[model samples]
Target: MASKYRRGFDITRDSLRVFTREPSLILLPVLSLLAVGSAFAVLTAIVFQQGLVESLVTNDLYQYGALFCAIAISSSVATFFNAAVVHCAAQLFDGNPTSVRDGLAAAWRARRQIAVWAVVAATLGTVLYILDEKFGVVGSLTRAVFNLAWALLTFFIVPVIVLDERRSLRRQLRRSGSLFRDTWGESVSATLGVSFVFLLVALPGVALGAVGFFVLDGILATGALVSGGVIIVAAIVGSQTASAIVRTALYRYATTGEGVGPFENRDPDTVFPES
Candidate 1:
């Protein structure tokens, strides 16, 4: 895979360059986070309308309903924002101008498909949640393996929803799975790159955390720790933006047979070598 396409770190570097070009891309993830928070707050109100702690402990329907809705909303919000990010990144890579508004509009256009996928995602999540909560170690292991496979299978879904336009959920899943199967090296490797990037950017926060406890004392240590937490959050946001960009780029390249962005004037994967 490394021999066939750009490696993860290289993809991360290029993705960061793309992020700098469209700095506002960072806002999508932030907004998604906030939206998910608000949604869960509303859901909490509904679930606790009877009795929060008591119902959670004794009311099976209320508890499961709350869990399902929470997972669905979270999945839907994440996919929505990821779609917007992909829209913006794809347009930019295609040498076109794109703004947050335009990206949002594109995602809105695909709301139907997103909603359907949300149901599917919610069911899977609820099942996994039940398994993990009830079966202990064996259930945890099963959940982990299923989660990984699901993630890999649907790796290109956000881009597919945004870029492909107006396909049924079944078709979209098929399309995404096929594309991922073909270019997994390019797609999954980008995650490794983003993870590497996160570790690099998060180091300052790690250092601050260490110093806060080990070197500083009392309130100053607390402040250092707080600041470190903020820095780590920022690093996460930045890495998420890069991940979105690389995801868009890899999907575009695999589908269109082009380079990642205008920054790279050649295809990310050049021609296949002689057989």
Candidate 2:
């Protein structure tokens, strides 16, 4: 059937259905982690090779703080790219016939945008930190608002960047802003839902970590690697799942002007609504 909707993204009930049907589809997150492992390895090497950590450990508190700040900035960049890749991966789960390689390539293609977002995020964070440091006026509240903004920005940043939309960042941001205008509540809820699942998965690991610390009198961290790995994996799952949900919804919403109201048994054809 012919449709008037633009060929873009929409969040929908069927999107979540796709995620639920194949929760393991989040394994894309794990693959993402592995793909970025070399980056981590390189960072580790830099820290050791340059004796930065050693210098920080031997120096005053401010030096340690500088090291941590650098790490935070770098991690934020990695996170933006990772989220973009997960967005692509979610497209595949939504039946877009996209592969992990394609997702990675797409992520690379959109690297500049992701990097720009990272800088924006970092600047916001730094501002928050500075405010907290200088005045200490409602610092927590300030940080919370900043974080919420960041989260909302993340909701459609990747999808907008990935879609073959020919628009300036201002226009993309405007469109993404419009898409989430009345739906921030739903976005936060969906985020919490996925996060809760990861928490459930990580509970055992948390318990193990606590027990290991107590049992070893803080001498040995039993299951350190295992538990850490599990926590990391859970993080990956949550991220990928959220990406899948958001992209699917965006794709649907863009096409049909519908929020994925509720999950219903749906075929790709029904879920997508002919465009």
Candidate 3:
């Protein structure tokens, strides 16, 4: 267990190293956020114009439908940018110069595959959301478990979609699952370390927000709130970018028995022992 934690921390550190080497990688997540925000804004406008918002608020079925549509669209937009990030990460791993434009172009080339995967992911997410909303404690627990499982299973979907676009969506998902199962230990470790890092990153924002709520007033309080929001957003974007880099490295190591950049010293067999 200690070894697993240590390994995860190492992976997380290396991921950060990769990001620092190419600070522009952060742009991918920022772009993703903007794209998703725009999509949500458009969807919200349409929903309100059509009076679907009222139905969504009053009717459970309508709410679910609206939520599903939102999830589908947001997931597609996120996946598109995520694919780009993975492409950039791969390039970084290969010691090649890459920019946000390069990543976006790569993702654009795989837009159709991303759309298919997004639909599948959104359907599963909606089902889980319904389970959590409609059922009691049991449903909530089931949804939580299933959500984690879904994340684990599809961990490599972005890398696969970006690197192996010829594969069918189902096959891509299967490949992702296979790769994850083989490197579950490293995956869990990397996730644990990343979670810890995010928590630390979020703490300052939380503290500022709490101080503003309890102590500050007037412009000072508003400034605190704004600063806190910025910190939180930066943390989220940095964490996401680091995670994509780590996952891309892991996928490359698992598939090719080779590592790149900070991962160069990591032995594939050690990370994912032959089983």
Top candidate on TM-score is 3
lDDT of 1 by residue, 4-91 (tens): 3444456667777775777877788788877988998887786568567787778777677778888889989988988898888888
For every candidate structure, what is the RMSD over all alpha carbons to the true structure, in angstroms? 3.9, 8.2, 3.0
lDDT at residue 63 of model 1 (Cα atoms): 71
Better of 2 and 3 by TM-score: 3
TM-score of each: 0.83, 0.68, 0.89
User: Over the stretch 1-275, how does candidate 3's per-residue lDDT look in tens digits?
Assistant: 55655565676678778867678778889988888888889888988899787788899888878778888898898889888888988988888899889999999999889889888888888898888887889889999999889898898888889997456987998999999998887776666677777777788998998888889999999989889888888888777877888788888878886777446887644653323
TM-score order, best first, reads 3, 1, 2
Candidate 3 collision pairs = none
lDDT of 2 by residue, 159-232 (tens): 67666373466676676666566455545544454555556667776776666766654335645646755775
- True lDDT of residue 173, candidate 3: 82
In model 3, the runs with Cα more than 4 Å from the true position are 1-10, 268-275
Model 2 residue runs over 4 Å out of place are 1-27, 35-41, 54-94, 164-167, 216-221, 224-228, 258-275
Q: Point out the worst 10-residue segment of candidate 1 by lDDT.
A: 266-275
lDDT of candidates 1 onward, in order: 0.79, 0.55, 0.82
Which pairs of residues collide in model 1?
none
User: What is candidate 3's local distance difference test score?
Assistant: 0.82
Residue 233, candidate 3: alpha-carbon lDDT: 84
Best by lDDT: 3
